[model samples]
Target: MTTPAQRQTALLVSVVGAVIVALDGTILLMAQPVMQRDLGASVAHIQWTSTGYLVAVAALLVIAGRLGDQYGHARLLFVGVLGFGAASAGIALAPSVGWVIVLRVVQGGFAAFLQPATLALLRLAYPADRLGKPIAIRTGAIAVAAGSGPLLGGVLVAHLGWRAVFWVNVPLAFVIAVLALTVRTPATQRGNSPRLNVTSAGLLAIALATLVHALADVPARGWTAAPTLLEFLAVIGVATMLTRHERRTTHPVVPPAVARSVPVTASMALLLVTTAGLFGALFRATFHLQDVLRLDPLDSGLRVLPLTVLMVLGSPAAVAAMRRYGARRTAIAGTVLVVVGIAGLSRLGPASTWMAMAAAFAAIGAGFATVMVTATGTVVGDAPPGYAGVVSGLKQTAMNIGPTFGIAVAAGATGTAASTMGSTLLILAALAALGLLPASRLPRRPARQEGEHDTTAALPAQAPTPQAAPARHTNS
Candidate 1:
């Protein structure tokens, strides 16, 4: 039987691995200047530090999430943490930029193993009705880690040099890995494992990769351009084939239940849209802050902390808000706040104070936290017991893809930095405003009373679907 203390230990362990994975995405950007000089790497080569890792992570996410579903989440967490630590150590000691990029890519592949599993594991950790604060906390941790990356990178690079950033992850990964080994594997992890639908998995990777590449190209080549349009078309065709193949296969990578779930599907859309708007707007605003306002990198990084801080604070606030407003309304309210904040950002000007911008970012961050908590609780809460990892992976995939889309949109919008950024922010506001579609679609479940402390409240029961594997599974 899963004990409460063991459950908490598992969640605690997962967060440590998640922090390192999240931090790497942005920390290396700050370290690039120092590393570029030290390693004699050209700008093109250095950019791969992020590009290679992210692409690998994106490509492997779906397959890895499925693997985590088949295997134990705790087992996947340990192995991923171990590999990530090893790769981080390798990158820290690398002699050339090429070697660093290669190691980073390896690290990214490992990093992919962390997120979906961690998300899936969270559902197991807390009961459905009690999951809001934990989800908020998880989302907040990721946002804080990503938000703090640059500042932390700047500091480490300033003092211990760029290598320090990778070194920092080593001990963290080590601790998490050790803790993961101790978590009692859930009953599902002890039985015979099923094989992944490799063909379906491959198709998903190709489709996702093509879509991401197409999105990345949208800035330089307009979306209507031949190559961009072709890529989009390619994604559509692959998606069709993927769906068809999955339907025929007895063991589809993404089970029919998960793919067809309204909460899961809708939440994934919101995840993608919200992240795109949130991160995309943040990127453009950073450029303005750095170039127009002439703030140093650290200061520019610090300015965004309001977003992270408020996001973190939103964890505790989620329960009260959900109690008063319930999940669907709370999510809608949060998304509206995101839209309003992006609109607030569009008003940026030469005279705009950093404090004012910080406040605006804070609003966006809080909204992000709320949506994440509400949507995640409902989606995961409603998932059939056996497929939490699949749903979690889809959610992570959306979040991962969101920033790329946002960056592409920001890049494609033509104007002076100020004009461009303002337009981009407005575009993001519109996208965030679209979140109401999904938010409104969220199931109108009643709320738990604020004074309720129960974690054993049973989730709303779901009927088993044809695609659902037996609950007894093994760590394959």
Candidate 2:
């Protein structure tokens, strides 16, 4: 049995691991220019530092999650954190940009291991009904880390150096490892230990990597560019082959149960569109702020502080709303807010006031927080415990893909100029409005409350058995 203290420690570890990863993603954006000049790297070379990491993480997430399920989440978490820190340290002392890019990809590999385990750790510690509040807390912490990254990065980069930003993750990782050591995570993987289907895993990885590569190129190369078209065709072909293989494979990277769960599948879709809208708008706004408005990086970050603030506050509020109005209703409400916010963004101009920008940011942040918390809760709570790692991985994979999709579309619209910001944001707003389709698919209410017997096939507290049929809800 998980003690209350152990539960709390697990939460801490999850939050810390999550924050470092999210913070690292945002913080590095601020440091890139400095790194470029210092390392004498070309724009293309510096772009790979981020692209390589993104491709590596996106490609390997499902496989990493499967590994965590077969092994133990705690063991994977420990190794992932250690390796991530080591890679960060290596980047800090790297002799050239090449080393930095290589180490970054290594760091991304470790991060793929770390992320799903964070959620799996939570699923292990908390009962289904009690998951929302902790997830809300985790969501809030992630918002804070992500929101403050640019400001923090600016401070570190200005006062200390670009390398200081990376150096910070080492101590944080050490702290996570120490706290994780005290948590008693029982071996939670259930069912027969089937052989991993390496062929399917490889295909999925290639598909995801190719998809990201194809999308990332949209901004630089037109959609009709030969290289872009070829990459996309490759993605489609590999995805088709992976689908066929998975249908036949007994041990798919994404568990069969998870693939079949409507709530899980819908939640993943919802997360993807939601993030795509959020990040696409943010990506465009960042350019409009710095390049068009001629604001410094710090000032640009501050103007959008309202978004962060709302995300922090809205997470808990969203959970409360979920309990009162149900996931479906709450998600619809949240999606509406995002649509309105993005529409508001479309009205921004070179002469727009900070107050106008802040209002739009706040609305988008609040809406996103609500949907994210609700969808994440549904994804975790609706699924059986045995498949938590893969589910978490699937959830994370949607998140990774969404931002790239959003950015690619937005980049295609705006190109290198801020003159088309208005039209580009309008396109994003339309895409966000489409999220209503998935939002409507969430459960009208949670199937059961906190103290009630869970209907899902959960491992017994004393003796986990393979015979338990994890209950699934299509439209509860």
Candidate 3:
């Protein structure tokens, strides 16, 4: 067993990596105009600095996660962190917006690699019973970073310029990469051997890229646009083939071995639904606060700072709820809070009342905290002994996809920013309501003992953990 000190180090390294990626994901928004000015790029070109990154990460996250499972999480984490650091520096020094956009895509790919490793490492290092707190803390950290990223980026841009934003990630990634080399976690032990079906992986990559691109176009091009329709058609066609291939293959991207675990599936669904609403609400809140209220980015970020703070502060309570009342009840309560939060946001009007906005943001953050903590812990805990990476990948993919869909839906709603935002929040409230049933379905507690390692929790209790499940090779 690893010492507690080592586990702490592992958590620290993981948290560091998570923070940089989460921050970079949205932080650049505050600095994009400055970047455009510096590069003499058009609004559309500068915009891809963010859009391309999102699409790339969404496309590559599952593949990266599978690779981590096949090789080693720690090995991948080290490479990912180092690569991200290099890409960040490259972006900072780029002379043109196009170069920066290209580098940002590379940065997102590195983020996909590092993200799954962090979760897999935490799952491996900690005991099952004790997983909630660490996961809660991890979730809280990432949430706060993501929620308040613009605020931080605004400060960096004002003081040091846009390049400072990317430059900040370089040091953190280097530190984490060094830690990956020095620290020995269970992730380095070489366990599950995930097989990659080239055909399926390629199909999934293309499908997701096309789907997200189409979703991204919804706001600008409308749902009826030819490009959007064509993109959806491509997604559907590719997905059908991929599904057929996965069903027939032994070592598909999802790994037929652990694909059917109800608990795992439910957790992923919970993540996707909750994040969709929560992220949508966040967008609406930002637009309402900044666009309607006429607050500057910094001011808007500051106004919502309490909401970000509450996300971090609320975790201990969530951890307590999980321990005392069980994950099922706690998660149910949390899902209800998401509905409450979105419902509160739906009440937002042309005037951004202080009390109404404050309360809504708080509810969203607190509620999302519980759901994120619970879903992450459950997805990891319920995986079959050899498929942590697979489930982890699936979980992260839901997360990435959630915000994409949320932002798209909210953006596509009719009228001005505030009006459409209000519309989307109402829709999100409905989505949150639909999530209630699944939230209530999670296991009361993890099925495995704290010290028992592996994805064995999803397997029959009496079954031995598949310590070395190898990649499959089809018969000729």
Candidate 2: which stretches are off by over 4 Å? 189-191, 446-448, 455-476
Clash-forming residue pairs, model 2: 457-470, 457-471
Residue lDDT tens for model 1, 105-209: 899889888877787786666545555666666767877788888888888999999999999999988888888888763554424335788899999988987
Q: Is candidate 2 or candidate 3 better by TM-score?
A: 2
- Full candidate order by lDDT, most accurate first: 2, 1, 3
Which candidate number maximizes lDDT? 2
Candidate 1 lDDT trough over 10 residues, lowest sum:
467-476
lDDT of each: 0.76, 0.84, 0.76
Candidate 3, which segments miss by more than 4 Å at Cα? Answer: 187-194, 350-352, 415-417, 445-476
Alpha-carbon shift of residue 205 in model 2 (angstroms):
0.8
Q: Which pairs clash in the backbone of model 3?
A: 128-450, 384-455, 385-455, 385-456
> Where's the lowest-lDDT run of ten residues in candidate 2?
467-476
